[model samples]
Target: MSSPPEQHSGQGKTSDRASSGKMAPNATNAVSFFNSTAFDTRVNALINEWHVPGLSLTLVHQQELHSKAFGFATLEPPRNCTPDTLFDIASASKSTTAGAVALLVDDEENYPHVQWDTTMSKLLPDDFVMAGDSYTNNVTVEDVLSHRSGLPSHDDFYFSKRSSHPDDPRTVTRNLRNLPISVPIRTKEQYNNSLYTVASYLVEKLSNKSFEEFLHERIWKPLGMSSTNLQPDKTREVGLGDRMSKPYIWKEESRRFQVLEYEQTPEAQGAGSVWTSSKDYALWVKAIMNKEAPINDEIYKGLTRPRIFSNPEDDDLDPFCSWQGYAAGLESYFYRGHQIIQHDGLISGFSSVHFFFPEFKVGGVFLGNSENAGTVGSGILVKEIIDEILEIPESDRTDWNARQHKQNDEYEESKKESQEKLRKELSANDDGLAEPLKLPLDVYVGEYWNIGYKEMVVQIKDERLYIDASDRTMAFALDLEHISNNTYFLGTIYDMLADGEEVDKIKVEFRFDANNRPVRMGIDQEASLDGQLILYDRVEESSGQGQQKVVVR
Candidate 1:
């Protein structure tokens, strides 16, 4: 649980131990409106209830700044969170990516020919094809950055816990031609991580530096973000790792948050992968909020300007909000007669939200160290702070905290119920089929290949069949359970098709030739361009050389 907030008086640099609920003005243009007792109690309760290990918050109104840290950065060793504690900000780093791109666009010396409207074909590798529709040939940088690139949300194609090619964005980018376009180019919004990875590569191409180096030399150093770094290597080099908050995932079986081992995967490069502190991030917020010189003024303007009409579905959470629209990196909506621009990000075990009112000059940064804390806990915290800053009527501030908490509870309960049903179904049907194995386990052991997804290997080990599906990012070995005849089921794994809704087991089948020898195998997984089952043919030997052929069904 979070300790009480250590209050600092506005006038002097001394700490105040008084339990007075009052407002005071600082010597500068800032003031503290939060009643310390009430604020501390509410935030601590939220953290404990949501199972968040730690969080850091920063609020900027006019020139006044307020920062608060709570709970333990890591529950194991037990380190209290401070303003300088680091957390993975996740996709909130998108704004930074967009900002860097916009800054490069405005720079004439380095990239004189590049612009937001520049065709992606001209900027990317000449061999990079958009496949299928001819309209895709006209796609530009703006289309991808604004989520209007007509691509579906196929994160599995590039990122997962088991990806073998972690550092190669080109592995996914080169395969984009094999995936079908979901919508007309620039017609609708569809969130895609593939395009962002491609965009980050483009930055490397244009700047002649690695994406991490570009961010460090150009943005981080300029803004004096000492506590921020793009990759774990730099973070460790600077000794910031000791102060970093370890990521945690809520395990339903354990009924508690468990520490997830962190991996420096390249798949998160362009879309997420930023680790920094709330205090350090507040510098970024202040720069954008004030619209400072060098890079902030122009980059902030370009990023905040609406490029698409997309709006978050949760706009009703604030009754006073008007229409919401998405910009390149930020989203804009009217709230209580003021234009509010914000964005939220979620990674494996961390979440963050950043927003600032351009007109009102009020901005807030929220970081949480749990899966539920970022979306649920940060949402409530930000709304309450906004209300306090605006001084909304007591009755007008509907109990949004309770409503969001209830939603979180419902989501968890629903997942538990679904998993229970799947467990029972799998347990009831674990017997050998009537028809038996078609051609023995040896016939099914071979390397399967796909153009989009590289390879999956099936092998028999310890008298049982198991599949090494690392190519699809399913890192662990899947044990094949006999169902009926040639068919077997991969039990318990969640489906990416239904957004983790359905746990319907995956079915695998082996096909045999006229001579009763295995020719190919099929699996009920989406790996084809047309969203069909993937097929892998036998690896035939050609002149003492082994070659595997990909067959899409």
Candidate 2:
């Protein structure tokens, strides 16, 4: 269903298409490589190998934009993707969020008090409270934006059921007090989406406008990225719905890609939710690289300043780089001796990678409709392009495809071994006697409450136990299978989000009161904390009428 590859080139003031018709030798070589037949063939091969339905690739060289698209945007309807086709750039939106905040920080006339060092307690004292007093009082806006706020990624807290104020950013920021802090304040980089939500809330408070509105007035409009928006629905509202790429996830069992629903919630707006096209995203990156408006020297410095090491123990030792670090919404690293500033975004079925070489004034943006497209597809192809531009010797070039394939195989094998070990453990019994439950299955059917996760309901359907968060749609529901005595495995609850082997690892244990009544439930939600379970108490009814003598821990 895919059409032939399409290419678009835009002329800039300093472009090779200028009146002089002159280009740097390196730029000329790069342009030739991008337009060559071999490059198109290579792109097609990568897309086919990775099973990516569609891909939009845009490059900025010599201040001009070169964009290309390949494959179908949607398989069933069969729409070929174009340079203007929009895809959810996921966490890549974080850079924009940081840029928006930087604009506010730089605008002394409008926001005199707002700065990178401004504490959240000072900004939103009532809403932004961390677990510890030190964290609650001293954590700054920079700390949160750079992901050094000491908060663990309690992603399920927002993604679970519809809480009291599910769509409200303030509610999300206020709930941070209930969650646990995994590390010490400013000790290490702990990527947390909730912190960005708090940052969005700060933007709202400072600007007296919604985060989306602020972004439009300041960042998007100035960069001429008209197609870029905060929420997915806006894409439809702007009459660009036809060009929006349908999200897809690779199903290993079926050896096919399955379509995934759009994430409609706005609570995590500042974290990872931006819809954009190759053309529009390239402009945004170009603006950043060219030191255009809204990206002044101070703003760019704040955006690219390395704050914390993302992975101190990353021993990959790839010849291309020396070190990597997190810088606000962007990540910075040495790629072939040139400082590369970039960010990768992956949410559900969409993936994107956008990076710029500040030294070379060259950049690349890749938007794809499959889950691992950014990591496997663009992540590999972009490096190959870089090698070509740098004129790296063929003998010295690293086989990134082989390296990635080997890593994927290793991960799959490890997961298979882990699943096998779990199955064996679950099937094994030290004693000959059966480990039957003392209480009936009905005793576990009840509502459980936790401050962090809100409410979870246990129900019996078709003679089998099932668990789901209250007010959540069926998409968040999970079937509960008894493992032993009082513990049950929440089947595949996070398999799609995390490792598939986690299906067997996520076990819920029911606790009993002195009278043998189930009173609470415990689940290992925070994988960062080894063997630590998040406890939820069972909700008891005041009246005896229609009350079941059941308890859920």
Highest TM-score among the candidates is held by which one? 2
Cα lDDT tens digits, model 2, 383-491, are: 7767876888999999988888877798789777765555445443722232545567798888888888877778887666777543331124556666665654434
Name the regions of candidate 2 deviating beyond 4 angstroms: 1-28, 159-165, 418-438, 461-464, 469-475, 488-491, 494-504, 544-553
Residue range with the least summed lDDT across 10 consecutive positions in model 1: 9-18
TM-scores, all models, native as reference: 0.80, 0.89
Per-residue lDDT of model 1, residues 141-202, tens digit only: 88878888777765555545445455366666667786656677877677776677778888
The TM-score of predicted model 1 comes to 0.80
Task: Report the alpha-carbon TM-score of model 2 versus the true structure.
Answer: 0.89
Clashing pairs in 2: 518-551, 520-552, 520-553, 521-553
Clashes of each: 0, 4
RMSD of 2: 4.3
